[model samples]
Target: MKKISFIGMTLLFIACTPIRNTNIKTNLLDNNTFELSEISTDATYGTEKNPIQVGGVASNEGPKNERRFLNALAGPNGEAVTYFRAGSCCPIKSKNDPFGSGSVMLDNYRVTWQGAKDTVSIYINMYDSGTLKAPKGFTIKK
Candidate 1:
């Protein structure tokens, strides 16, 4: 009887237990924010469906050229545009600058959802001259 009761209690405990939330981090930026600009939930470093995420766009100069599309890490997305610089220009004119000589950079993005309510931060070690990081990672909820 004692053995049977212990087994039943163990099973009950297992059944009532909840799955623990997991945290994952990845190297988002290596070189050239443009390389990171092409980022998408479908093409992250390792797993395709990481709950946290970030990304956006910036023009070489002038007003932001690309639209913004942001989302959470679990599902919602974030940021949509990027910018890059070109060697043809010098001192880099902010206005009336030719985009041909410039490039788009997409770096700096983050997502928060469910167990993740804090802000997400993207780190870039090094890159070319033309690249813009996202302002801030988006917030998400479960």
Candidate 2:
């Protein structure tokens, strides 16, 4: 009975523990945006539905973080990029969701360049901080 109770408590503790957000301390620039320096090679990096996981801005700064990530990207050939919020979708399991919903929905953005005929869609999860990078077929700002 004692072992069973201990095991049950351990499981509960693990389930409720939130991931630490100590990874991006050095990557942020003045709280205005993130300083991304690499482009993602994984095709699924940005195409894996509406959860790009490209940044971490916590709950209050979620929208701002999404914009900062988009601002860091350029077209395949370094063309000027423009984007707008496409709305929120995809509830990803996250420890950073402040609402205690156990998950956070990602923000979708439709990005386009001056000469591009079609827009690229990216899902962003600002609640969870991940390695920030530009999606494939895109470039990062210098």
Candidate 3:
């Protein structure tokens, strides 16, 4: 019936609307990709002690935002960067917890570039948004 079709169209419209046009808060290459523009000189910025907070998880878009951030980085001297999810660890309290559990776990990504002797771990928090920056020894892609 037309009533059912109207309801379906309404849902579709709502689904396509962005949860938060946070592209203004953080540079974006696309709806799902983050374009990093800064570098963190602080040694602990991306370490286990202080993870990169990419957020968007409360909107069910955390994992995608995480990859977008990683994809926007290069090596310290502008070499192509590659990374993988090492695992999730270090649960911490957050106001953006999607589950209302008051805590969200951090995701660890091991990153490296050619000629690098060893991979470095980058800690990321997908549950809370922050001004994203490349970790020390990494560079932002142009």
Candidate 4:
């Protein structure tokens, strides 16, 4: 009876343990493409004092794009990185020409660098212009 109880407890403990994703080393957004206007970094995660945000329009190419972009970022020591979509801001609208144009599609992402002790939250905004630029303190490569 005691042997069976011990085995059951062990199984329960194992099952309850959370699993971490390890195989996140490939470009998930290989097919999807978008031009990044600016990239910014903030020390605070999410707080009133130092809000986390990006400049320009925020937009997403959908789930595939988000996954690909997040996976492509490397940690300080080239570690694998994972990300989750935190939220988004209101979409801006513009009207003038036949096709109607607007700017600022901001998207927020919470990025985690596997094997690293710190995590970062960033925002990616897709602008109408086909240009990519990094903010004063941040840099991005495509």
TM-score of each: 0.21, 0.77, 0.79, 0.41
Tens digits of lDDT, candidate 2, 17-133? 986653564266546556777888888777536355644455366677787778778899999899988888777787767889888787878999989989998878777776777
CA lDDT of every candidate: 0.30, 0.75, 0.85, 0.45
Model 2: CA > 4 A from native:
1-23, 26-33, 48-50, 54-59
Better of 1 and 3 by TM-score: 3
Please, what are the lDDT tens digits per residue for candidate 3 over residues 1-142?
9999999999999999867433336778877568887798899998867888887776787899889999888998999988999999998988777788988899999999998999999999887777898888999877
What is the C-alpha lDDT profile of model 4 across 1-142, one tens digit per residue? 9999999999999999976322222222345433443454544422322332222222333344444444445555555556677787645542211234543345667766656565566655333221223322333434
Instruction: Give the clashing residue pairs of candidate 4, or none.
Output: 29-68, 57-104, 57-105, 58-104, 58-105, 58-106, 59-105
- Model 4 TM-score is 0.41
lDDT of 1 by residue, 8-52 (tens): 999999999975321212233222212233333333332212211
lDDT of 3: 0.85
Off by over 4 Å in 1: 1-41, 45-68, 71-98, 117-142
* Model 1: lDDT of residue 40: 35
TM-score of 2: 0.77
When sorted by TM-score, best at the front, the candidate numbers are: 3, 2, 4, 1
Q: How close is candidate 3 to the true structure, as a TM-score?
A: 0.79
- To one decimal, what is the Cα RMSD in angstroms of model 1 from the true structure? 19.8
Candidate 4 stretches with Cα past 4 Å from truth are 1-29, 32-63, 90-103, 127-142
Give me the candidate number with maximum lDDT. 3
